[model samples]
Target: MPARERNHPLRLLTGALASSRPWTFLRSSQIGHRIRHSLSAKLAVAITLAALVLLLVFGIIVASQLRSSMFETRKDAILADASLRFSSAQSVFSSSTATSPDQVQESARGALASLKASAAGAGATNVALLRSEGSTASLRINQIEDEQMRGLITPQMREAVAQGGAQWQSVGIRASDSDKVSPGILVGTQVQLPRAGTHELYILYSLAADQRQVDVVLRVLVLSALPIIVTLPIGVFALLHRLLLPVRLTVSAATKAAEGDLDVRVEVHGADEMAALGRAFNAMTSSLQDTISRYDELAKLQQRFVSDVSHELRTPLTTIRMAEDIVWDNREDLPAHARRSAELLHDQTERMEQMLADLLEISRYDAASALLDAEERDLRPIVTRVVEACAELAQRQGVPVEVVAPARAAAEIDERRIERVIRNLVVNAIEHADGTRVTITVATSATDVACRVRDRGVGMTQEVADHVFDRFYRADTARARTTGGTGLGLAIATEDVAIHGGRLQAYGEPGKGASFLMTLPKHAGDEIASWPLALWEDE
Candidate 1:
């Protein structure tokens, strides 16, 4: 497709979809990560849940209190009405106009009916009159308007009413027309009739009206709470976002500062604590920027001094080399002591030249002027060459050196730098071998190649190992003398590997052994995921 044609909106959209197809999982994970990490979301959810719990508790208490109050008020009204009707019915039963058993029975039934009629509008009510023991059988009245409610008068209620006091019990009321039941109250008392006998009178009142009223109130409350429940969290979230805006800005500024943008500053708006925090953070970043600027200047000056000194010493060193060579060549004509002095002077001059070269190299690294001459080459030959070069030193130290490698191990690297690194590691191993064996292993993975040098000798402690690659650092100064080293070999090696984006690590334990592992990628800029050989293998 032409570039302009591919730039069309529809085409671009399609291309975007195609490109993003494989990243759907990544996008979902990112969303989940955001939700899990977002402070506002977490706080909002917590506050919402807490508010819901509190509202639930409050609704329960209100509903319970209303229900109790309704029941108590209904009970008082029922008791008052029952007492009035009971007194009127007793007067009717004791009337002199009805003397016979038939008349007494007739009067008893009429009195019960009158009581029911009098209490009609109060609420849904059931009336029952039953003869108790000691009543004349012929004159006994057993009357009940609702059969279901008559059974609700329990034996306990009847006995309590028979003991001369009115008794009421809460009960369930089932309608005759349906299977549904509602709550009710049953009141029972003894009623004495002239020429007849004592009878139990019971009145049952339905509380469905009170229940309906309570339901309406609960519904209102629930409806009222719904909006609050919905809006409270939103309000809280808005407040939190507003309150935390300064903190968010501060965090963003701190993040930029951490990423080396020390000029980044938080904006201060008010005289509150958040504003104070912003001011403090700005002051800290400014101080850090100044400190870093000063340190950078000092580092540049140090590098320049080292470079100048190395270059300045080179001229004098060259003159000394030329003069010493002439003396060394004619030392045979002098006395034995003079000959010995000439040899020592020549050796010292050579050592000085080597030290100066190392210093110049270090300066290049410090100035970041070092270049990589990387090429595709086999590493087996490189390791073998380094081992062969260290053979004389290994023999003198009474240490046996061995090379373990495959036939071919390849990587893209600066062969010169790699050779120098391997040579230093081998020489260091030989000097510290303490009459033990020094082994070099070369191995390769799909992406990387590695070389490891192991010496079973007087190993270093953790503290010494940590400083092994620092310039002029020596585990023991006596060891450097034995090998005539400048003490910058490992430091240079470290820089070499770092420039190639590879790793060089040293491991050691006191009196055990020391190992140095160098791992490099096969392709430039490729990351090395795994090493081919273990740096420290358990014995």
Candidate 2:
């Protein structure tokens, strides 16, 4: 396969590794989210990153100090060796027996050869003898052993050598045979010959050994650091997992407790802070469980008392209703004041009986005994009947009610409860409508049906709208109970709809109007996906 199109596993892996960055991975949303949510991941990443930074800084400092110290020590050794060689070479030229240029050249060549041979054992790479500039002698000798070594000694080194003491410079030593260059030091000094005048002697020493040593130390540091950097996250993650085990258990216990498992408790082992937290959590749940138990008992007692009272009052109410009917029938034969009093008494007695019936129904709901006797039935008849039943109130309040429903609006619902719910909605609308027309819009979809009772009346504010369905919550507290409302109509309607797996919502804007929308599944046991009618009517 062609290399570019090979798709080799190792190539793919290397490409990914080369392109990936630690910060990029850390900043990724998935990883960031996990780290933010998970205590273990957060601690692991933090500790590992800190270790990596400390290791890198420590390694850089050690390598820099080690390389600098090695170079300085090698420079000193080069200077000392070159000085000893310079002394020996100078002595050889001073005792030379040369008279002509040819003889001086020969002596210079011999001294250079000897110096090269002696310094070769001390890591010297090249040596040179050059006549000083402006030298006036009968014979002047300028000899360089290697051409490449000439340029290695800078002009600055030459000038420093001319001032009378030994001078050295760090440089690169190019090989005589190849282009390879190694780190080196050049030491130069002035020398005098028998026939030749002043001359400069230079020695170049290769630092390849010292360079190799430093390279070795660097490789060791990098290799050791690689394992440490790779293992830090894994080790920290494992340690965090072990350390956070108690927290995990506590979280699990808390979740179960939130899900109504009041008996759930964290398992405590060691006498640590985590153990203390577990103890505190267990105590809180126990107290909450006890408090809920007491509340449940009180609620049960209240329901039973209400249920018993409602049952007990039915007998007396039935007796009073019989006597009230007889008096009402005979009111036309009595005085005008007596007849008015009889009418008022009859109205009050009827209101009390209705309130008692509502209380019994509420008791059933509170005790969780409410049942739905659902049947597939057309809802238009129910809506029409509710409108007809509340026709008197709507007429009395001067609020005209309009029912806009399809001829065949059908749903699975208990006829009695649904009728009661519709009745309550109609009555409530007429009462609060402020003499404006009340509209009952019934719409249906494939899965759900809805009814909206919209009234252009004295609209409630948002706060009133929110709690309009709460039992005994009157928006106008000082208003007389002229409508004979028990104040549980909306609340009972809400419960009725909820029992059928439906929803009832209220929408209102002060001074505009109020709307109550009831949505239900068309088929029994089906979920309501969407409403057929909008909650707010379009202006």
Candidate 3:
């Protein structure tokens, strides 16, 4: 493939990359939207999560402490009740001195049975009695035997019996034919009698009632915590929903303002950041709308100025051209000075006509009325033709005219305007050549064609090059007078090349020759691919 075709894809890729780059900053409306939607939701979720964590921690501490205190209170009450029963039994038994051994034993048994019945009514279970020698036979208990009482009595019960009457102890007991055990306080006392030496009386009070109370407290805790946990999320959602409405409204108003509704303003009700944002947005929109209105008015005035100048110049130019035509017709009958004067008037009138034509062309381009008549043709032939046309003037000034055409140079372009560009470059080169060599070079690639015109002339400085394409601009005022050339040539050429989506560049240095290059696309409406002409070279 040719160099231009190879570079075409690269140029296209570069353009695409440039266009697809992300903007450096977000627009105001976009920023507002993000803050409105994301910030509010995030804040709400954060608060809800924090509240749940705090509630969970407090609930756990309260439930644990409540359970512990309730259990402790129940334990203390059970111990007190056991102590009372033991003390009463000891007092009753000790006060009876007339009772026989068997009768005393029967009476003690009856007292134990009654205590058991009362404990059962109070939700206690597994109430029992044990003797001090670890024997149930001595007491003649009928309800439960010594084996059953073994687990209920401990070494503490024996110590209480030895110490004195009316002392108490607590133990866990397992009953016969039962897999479960119940915790209880054991009340033991010593009984002194005449025939019987000393007997130990035991009373057991189970802790089942306290265990049931703890269960009730736990149930209440669960029932109470359920409603609080359920309501927490709902409350957070409601609060967030209320706060977020203003933010949503502010965003909607901002969107309308961005879409050119300058009159759109937000209703700011509260002293908050959202309200402040709404006020700022409204002010910005109002300012932008005023600026745009002023710019439109200025643009209309500029258009009117251009239109008035065009209308004002046409009638005078027409009258001047007709007057020149009459003078040319009678030139042969006039004196020598008169003839020379008429010729000068004709030339100057023609130059004026060309200048006016250039102005009209520029105005058309400015108004976007210059349409392209594009086609595919080799640019080498066009450059060659333009140079040949200027050959006579080059010869008259003793300047060498050189043409360098590549093997193939083709492009899609408006032939007439592109031809005008070539003619202008060649003419400008001859006028500034200062009796030196002028070279026109043409080259082609797959996607573009380029032409360069170089002249060893009275070259321009940087200052002149900067405004070289400005209308009526000249490098030297005296040099412009000698050439008798209309100054709009280069400017019109620049405009023509731009209309073809091409570039026209001038490169020069003081006392050095100048080179003008034109780069055009290979396809009409396509971008330039390869700039075949370099700006500077060693040679």
What would the TM-scores of all predictions be? 0.86, 0.81, 0.48
What digit string (tens of lDDT, one per residue) describes model 3 on residues 204-306? 5665555445446555655575676567656766777788777777778778877878777777777788678777777887888899889888876775676
What are the RMSD figures for all models against the true structure? 14.7, 8.7, 19.4
- The 0-to-1 C-alpha lDDT of every candidate, in the order given, reads 0.80, 0.82, 0.68
> Which candidate comes out best when scored by TM-score?
1
Question: Taking the candidates one at a time, how many backbone clashes does each contain?
Answer: 0, 0, 0
Q: What is the lDDT ranking, best to worst?
A: 2, 1, 3
Segments in model 1 whose C-alpha atoms lie over 4 Å from true places: 1-54, 96-109, 131-147, 175-181, 193-196, 476-480
- Compose the digit string of candidate 1's lDDT tens values, residues 1-539: 00011111111111112222211224577766775777776687689889987987786677667767777787778777777777787777776378776777677778778888887766637788877755665554445446675578777777777777677777777778998667777777788777556788887777777766766777778778879988987888888878988998999999999999998999899899999999999999999999999999999999999999999999989999999999999999989999999989988998898899899999999988999998999988888888788778788889999888965789889999999999989988888789999889899888888999999888888898789999889787654456586789999999998888789999988777899999988886678877888889867
**Whose lDDT is greatest here?**
2
Model 2 CA deviation exceeding 4 Å by range: 1-38, 85-116, 127-182, 186-202, 218-239, 406-408
Model 2, 9-53: lDDT tens digits are: 111111222333444343778878988999999999899889877
Q: Candidate 1's error at 260, in angstroms?
A: 1.1
**Cα misplacement distance, residue 437 of candidate 2 (Å):** 3.6
